[model samples]
Target: MAFDSGTVSFRRYAVMGRSPREPSEKMLQTLEGMSFAPGGSGASQEVEYGWSGGRHVLDTSFSFEHNVFGEALHFALRVDTNRVPAQIRRAYQIIEDEAASLGNAAGKKGVKHAVQRRIEADLRSGRYRRSRLMPVLWDLPRAMVYAAVSPAAQEYLLNLFERTFELRLEPLSAGRLALRRMEAAGNRRSYEDAHPTRFAGGPDGEERAPEYPWVPRGDYPRDWLGNEFLVWLWHHTETEGGVVATGRGELGVVIDELLEMHCAFGETGRDVFRASGPTRMPEAVDALFSGKVPRRIGLIVESGGSQWQLTLSAESFACAGVRLPPAEQAVSPRAVFEQRIDALRDLCETIDALYEAFLKVRFAGAWDAHVAAVRRWIARAARRQGA
Candidate 1:
């Protein structure tokens, strides 16, 4: 368990509708108490918000592309050991402390695996099981915007890591998870076997580990990415039903952007479904029936009556599928949604059957509650006459 990996990707998540509140004196004092240094009069000093440390994230990124789910203001941080300055011990202390906090955010059962828990604690203590952080990396300042997330609740406490140590970091996206994990685990890749389900093999070899039942089905092509692979998938889907695509090719363009879900997942360190826009609904049933890729999704929708508020989320969500109960094995989001879809289709079938029964017989109170006496009588007669 000797430490021997590359840079560690740390995350902190928070939720709040209120805009940035001026840091209270008590808040600043608490941070100072925690050893988070205010910007110094040295090369990295600032006049206002000098309370801010190395501002690398801001210096490197201005108005970074912001993505959200539920109610979170998401961002990233990378601790470049190659650039750490000598007077930043206090800063490193805060980073370590904040990372520890993230690891413990969910408490004892918070972590998904015992090994992950060990890694989290070890990572907080800078006791990498395989390798140490690269030397000479400099960290800059970051911000922890307010957010509110749910279900997996993984985005909790990212802002703590940001304000404490000035670093640039982001979680891995779904598709790009392979690359990110490969880097983090390095020689210790076996560590990820801890995942309840893995979206790694075959053209679609997925996770079989059902220990962590909350894991959702992924949208990635089991193992294909390039053209030939895509072609193979295209033909395969055709066999089920023609591939679902936009009439004007908008879907293709949108899909490319969606592919970055892998990167987004890695950066945010959360598994987010690569959702399709509701701009145009699917043309075929297979696209959704397979409950596979190009997920049955919507961007934003108008809810009840009329309103300007949006109802669509950028995350992947399935409304039907056989679910992995708390006691059973873990399943994918797609699986869960497919289960729901199946249930709905089944429900439809059941209702269709019941409607047929009613059509054949006139049951008591079957007519509208407000039906006129003569209308009700006529309806009853029609039912008896097989009308």
Candidate 2:
């Protein structure tokens, strides 16, 4: 999950508030000051977290060369927690309760107090301490931070990042990005009036409200655009051949590996398809006709002479298990890192371009025509599958 090496998986965040844009003595000093410290939380605390040099759990020695690359700052968040096994704690409690019963009969209250003391003693001794590291990359030019961490770990990361750099982090989800694009394009009203489109109609040719429990129901249901984007991609790839004209040039997109769909109504649950071409599968069409929206999908994008593969989460827009094109083997480590970073940047920009294209049609006056075409395609696909 590290950005410097191996396949990367990360959630994007927009860095907010004030902070230095480049590597400086002050930034280095701040990182060192907030570096991870074992037992820093004291005996009473159960968890502790802070920044690390990202080389290892114990690597807190931050410097310009190791931590900074171009306009990006790289680091890791190290979290340690003290715990006692449930079985062990229960056994100790049983022993204490038995001792109390056999002796002065200190009662339920006394037994509970004794158990608490034992657990606290174990925590203080660090008998069951666990530690983990989450890698983070702060791209100064983009005002974005990419962190390879779980949802729970992200909370710790956000808090520690704010404390260290005096900045806030807001989730850079698909909806948020779309809103930004719409605002920039002066079509904010179009986005505000958007609503979920029913790609597949009812059996009786009656219009039905689209079931999108995950999307906010309001004038500006921007979150629903994520689902629409995936469906659009699937339709575009199947019908239009997936040749998207991006700012960087033409990019070839293929829906490959995996496709995960969930019922928008929160009723039929979810279906997952795994294959060389999951989007072309019969089951995928059935899922779409059954009021399902894609929640995640594996994508392979080719542009210029390079190809990148990654799975994208619709709502959060997180990129997971990204495989960038191979770098030259004879290059130095720094050069390799720089090459990978550039590739990642290209990948992000390509996706953004695709989204921007979708927005143009989405906010256009002829959007209804586009929706009708999509509905026709869905119906035809469903009938072909005998659904």
Candidate 3:
């Protein structure tokens, strides 16, 4: 969905390389030059993608007013695909084969070849083409791109972005974000030495090895922090009444609507709970004690007379279905857009602050004591469930 008119959902990427903060006429011209064009020359060409105006899939005409909004440039990636149904193609092939066999027993092979060529030519003619659009927002000042696209389509965006602007896009995963924060705070060594915390003990009261299936293999070492952050949120919310103090102010966090947990060791599979206050359910506590961690969680955060709701994916730190606070009515389009962007920034900063809070206790010497407390809490929860 477009960011302008609906709940925003996107994956963030850091734009690397030299890029101008200001939107220029030259950039607009480049976008126009690379705009999507239809019709493929070869039948094997299944997909084609390029730039388009963020307003709609068919709008390739770019201008400052249409695409540029202060330091952010809004646009879209348009992808077109063509494919013939396999069943129909096979039916045609069968018909052709039967006709060829009936007409010429000796030249059946040549007739089949010609039939295949004809079918391929029809496919190349765009007989069955479909188009889709993925919105992108480039925050120039922050050097970040928020792309609303699936993981499978992300490569297309990265390639197109690099080709268009001669810049690289690096995914801003949880591990990378934590590293950046640590470096800025002069605690890089602490982050580098960090590992997953064992919050719950094993059946025999022994510590278990960390198993974080949510963190991608070979990713930055501290990616497990994201999973831990969620577990910490769960514990803190349940025990502390969900009140968190941040730089901005005090915010209330509520875990509701959805809770997804996966076996860290990839042994017990995963469980998903959907309902109001899913975290309070007994099954959720069971999943935690069974060595499952939060993979994604739906949360509501309220602060400063504003409330934001979204589902956070732990590994990539992507927010999905983000519903922001309402904006003032009867404002100009630019004003509305500005308000939305500001609200989005507020949501992001609030989350960052929460993560930083978690990092403080995580990297401190009191971490072992914190783990002991968490283990006690887990044991108490299990006892309550048994009762």
Candidate 4:
């Protein structure tokens, strides 16, 4: 799907400012207090803001992030995957639910920006940007669902986060209390959309088929119950030899071309006004496979041995906000794949940075774009899901 969202690079962060803007003394002290000192087996960790002065810590995390635009703080809470025991997958309807609802979503009971202001309390309590931690893998499915919701909804979650995770609340219990609110909203919404509806046969009326042909009887899209994605990845990698499966887990699919392109963009992230474009890695992929990785290729030979030839200069890698490591640092193909993840996270952060611009997307309306993206992702995943 074009929803690949332009693999945004993972821009390194630095604490070069005070309270974002207007650099207040109070804000500086607050920022320092929120930071953690190295401790125990790991490096120094910062005290989280919401639970800074509280006794509660939960199975999940409540974090207050500093938005780059420096206009506001984005407060969020997410659940941990580890605590989602396997047994729960079968016993309950949902094994895990991790979403960051925005505080400013419409229908919330607060003045605009009121929720954002409260996030300041997190600052004073010693919960700064580092408190939530960086490079943490987000719940991709939950993020996809969030993408399905409205921006106002995103803002609303942000606001509610500020309130529920006050400096005095325990982090863990706060999560449970917050989830109750979510479940309550879900219950009411479920009934609202429960009006009876019926579907008629197709126009040709050859034979009746279910609404979702991929699903069998009594089956839902139970993500936890299935590693359907990995299953699909395994098969695809087997069939498409050019795309090798990772030795570890299948975090994502990687094209050989993306690796080369990553090497190309490796040194350019520092430019704020950098240009965005497509990569010419398909050609490079061919070179790596046929020439570099493979010594010689003779058409008349056995016509065997890893018969994978990536298209030359095929240019399948589409990128934006790509940054490469300094050429001084040795780059490898695997590094590219890892960078892809960081790039995507950076894209999310950028989407947030340009919040006002995205709000414009709300007018020209991201509705059509969103719809188009959904269709594309489904089609792509279906075609490539199992090769």
Q: Give the poorly placed runs of model 2, Cα more than 4 Å off.
A: 202-208, 215-221
Which one wins by TM-score: 1 or 2? Answer: 2
CA shift at 237, candidate 3, in angstroms? 0.7
Q: Write the per-residue lDDT of candidate 4 for residues 212-245, one digit (tens) a residue.
A: 2212324222211111122222223334542322
> All models: lDDT?
0.26, 0.84, 0.84, 0.25
Comparing 2 with 3 on TM-score, the higher-scoring candidate is: 2
Residue 6's lDDT in candidate 4: 32
Candidate 3 TM-score to native: 0.92
Q: How accurate is candidate 3 locally (lDDT)?
A: 0.84
User: What's model 2's lDDT at 224?
Assistant: 71
Clashing pairs in model 3, backbone N/Cα/C closer than 3 A:
none
> Lowest summed-lDDT stretch of 10 residues in model 4?
294-303
Model 4 TM? 0.20
Worst 10 residues of 1 by lDDT: 1-10
Q: Which ten residues in a row have the lowest lDDT in candidate 2?
A: 201-210
Q: Higher-lDDT candidate among 1 and 3?
A: 3
Query: CA RMSD for every model?
Result: 23.7, 2.2, 2.4, 22.4
Q: Tens digits of per-residue lDDT for model 2 on 224-320? A: 7888899988888888787987677887999999999987766778899999999888999988987888999999999888898999988888899
TM accuracy, model 2: 0.94
Report the lDDT tens digits of candidate 1 across residue range 62-103: 121221111221222222112223345445455555655777
Off by over 4 Å in 3: 40-44, 103-115, 201-208, 219-221
